[model samples]
Structures are given as C-alpha cells and as structure tokens.
Target: MNNQFKDWKSNLDRFFGHDFWGDFEGMMKPSIPYINMYQYDNEVLCYVSIPGMNHPKDIEVFVDHATLTLKGKIEINHRGGHQIKAEIADGTFERTIDLPFPVRSDKIDATYKNGLLIVQLHRYISDHTRQNPVQIRHLEDE
Candidate 1:
C-alpha cells in the first residue's frame, strides 16, 4: 500500500455481509447511541448520544487513567398505557478507551443536555520522581 493512498482505503470498503434478519431493519435501524471523541491541550471531551432521556443522573461515568467506561439508561413510551421501547440502550453500556496521557480523575467533569452526555477529563502532568537510599542511626538497646 502506498503512503498517499493509505487514507483512502477505508473509503473504498464496500461491505457485502449478511445479518440474521433481512436488510429492512438490520442495516437501517439505529439502536445504540453514537459517541465522539475530542482532544484538547489539557483535557479530553467525549460526546455520547442518548436521545429521549429525561435525567442525566441516570447515566454513569467511570474513568481510570487510559480507560473510560460509560453506562446509562433511557426510558421510552409504548402503547397500551405507556410501556417501554428502548432504542438508546436502557441496560449496561460500556466503552473502554486508551488515552495518550494520564488524566486527572479528581478534576473530571460531565454535563448532559439534549440527550447527549459530554464528559471532560483533565490531563495530568507526568513528573519523574526518583528514589534514593537514606542512612539511619541505630538506637542503643535498653
């Protein structure tokens, strides 16, 4: 593969696969929410789409260094006295990721609006600390 055409490889990929069901609802339905990532000088922003959710507190966000997991629930209305029709994944949702640098977990922040959850994690500065041996004086026995 040439260096110039490497980026174009993904654009030419024409998927010719089959699913359990027909193409009517298999390839056209959007069930799970989509997520986007953005990097900044001292923080990283994650945008997750979860439309029709009423409260942001229902969602969960977990982070440890390079890994981040997001779990959330969404409620829906159905016929026959308001049932459930979940398209935004009302159960456990997870997304594990690797960050370029360490993040400051204590300073991480999150906000949700318009059914989109936006998470911001501050970056931590890596400071190489060294360890050295120290001499101690022994106490005399009683």
Candidate 2:
C-alpha cells in the first residue's frame, strides 16, 4: 500500500541522513577529540588523541576526587589561499570524565607525545560522601 511505502521511505531517509555514521550531531557539533581510559589496581591511565594540538600550555588537565577534566583549543591557521573544505575541528574543547573510583588528585600526571596526551592518576580509598537516608519522626513523638 502507499501508506506502507511512505513509512518505509521515511525510515530510509532518516537512517541515511542522520543515523548513519552519527551525522545527526556531526552536522551541528564540532569535531571532538577521542579518548580511552584504563584502570589498574592502584592507578588509572587515560589516553587522549588530539591531532593538530601541539602547544603544552594550550591544553589544561585537571583531576578531582572523582572527575577528570580536559580543556584545550585547537587552532589551524590557513595561509592566504582558496580553501575548498576543512573537516578538522579548530576551536575550544572541554571534556570531563567521571572516574569509577576516587583518585588521589595530588598524584595526577600528564604528558603529551606525538599528539597524544597521556594522563596517569593514582587511586586512593576515601570515605564516600554519597547521600544518606534520614529517619522521619512523627509529630506526636517530638
């Protein structure tokens, strides 16, 4: 039937345009850096792949008890010339990662090599500060 055909065409269009290769957000959002995290017995290692970002001071890395933040800007200067297209992202980017467990903020270390940023964080056992349930009392008891 025509109705079934229309539904099939719409689904195909949606899949090809937005869902395929994650183009839904790709068209709107700038390209972001790729990262991978690994956890060990006493430390956590993170690798960030950000090409075209060379300056050390341009990137800032921070770690808290349960979070790691990475902020940086990628600038690609094009000399006076005609440009057809550019897919490389060149702008400020900030990415925050939630750690699985508490980490020692003071023992965090980072290094950049071959356009890859490596971050190492030492783990520490700390008292969790999660919300605790409170007991409710009746008005007559007080």
Candidate 3:
C-alpha cells in the first residue's frame, strides 16, 4: 500500500512537470531582502542583508519622507559544477520600507560592509506639527 502511494504521487508529479509545486509556491510569494530597523528618539537605523554582490555600487538606496527603497542584484557564481540543489535567490530585486517618522534627506548616511547595508537617518520635524492658531470669523459682526 505504501509503495502504491509513492508510485501514485510520483506519477502525479511527473504529469504536472518537474518542480511544478515549487514553481507555483515561488510564484505565490514575493522575493525581497531581509532587513532590520531601529528607531531612536531623534534618529533611525536600518540594516539590510544582501549577499553575493561584488560591489556596493550594485545596490541603490532611496529615501523619501517616511519611506526607504532598496534596489539591487545578487549574483552567485556556480563555479562549473552540476547544480543539484538551489535555495538561495539570485536576481534583481527592489524593496521599500516604511519609517516611523519622516527623515531629513540631507542628514542620511549609508554604508555597505560584510554583505550588510547599514543606513543612518536623522529625524526631521515638519512645520505642520508646530502650534498654529486658526482664525474664527463672526458672520454677525460683519
């Protein structure tokens, strides 16, 4: 009975094609780099993991008011061997992260070292947060 089950499963897999379930699972998920973020009273720090890149220039970092964007490609050298298994992803990818507070564009720093990209951002205070009084007009007075 166990052998019959195995044969039946093998036949089903063969009919569907090689790695059909794997391909379907990959399609159902979005690939993105892993990241860690830290927020301080007046600053924000972000750490992104990106391996197999030759140079820091391979990645592009963008900062908006409260969002950070990372775009890059990860390349893996096969080194002339038959690949029996592959789990690591290697390709062009873009990921955006939302920050807790708006950051100052001028006060931003980024460094790539040991396959990790570190970003330091200073918080910015917007004018809208300041105390502003609204004038109330009396129509009867007019």
How big is the positional error of residue 133 in model 1, measured in Å on the Cα after superposition?
28
Question: To one decimal, what is the Cα RMSD in angstroms of model 3 from the true structure?
Answer: 7.2
Which of 1 and 3 is ahead in TM-score? 3
**Candidate 1 lDDT tens digits, 1-142:** 6965554443344333433234544577554557788999878988888776778877778899877777666555445675455334454455566776778888888898887888888888655532456867677732
Pull out the clashing pairs in model 3: none
Which order, best to worst by lDDT? 3, 2, 1
Any idea how many clashes model 1 has?
Answer: 0
lDDT string for model 2 (1-142, tens) is 9999677767876867745434544678744667889999888899988777767788989887889888898777678999799877667889888987889877888899888899999887656854578988898987
Candidate 3 is scored at a TM of: 0.69
Is candidate 1 or 2 superior in lDDT?
A: 2
Q: Give all candidates' CA lDDT scores.
A: 0.69, 0.80, 0.87
TM-score leader: 3
Steric clash pairs (candidate 1) = none
What's the CA RMSD for each of the models?
12.9, 11.9, 7.2
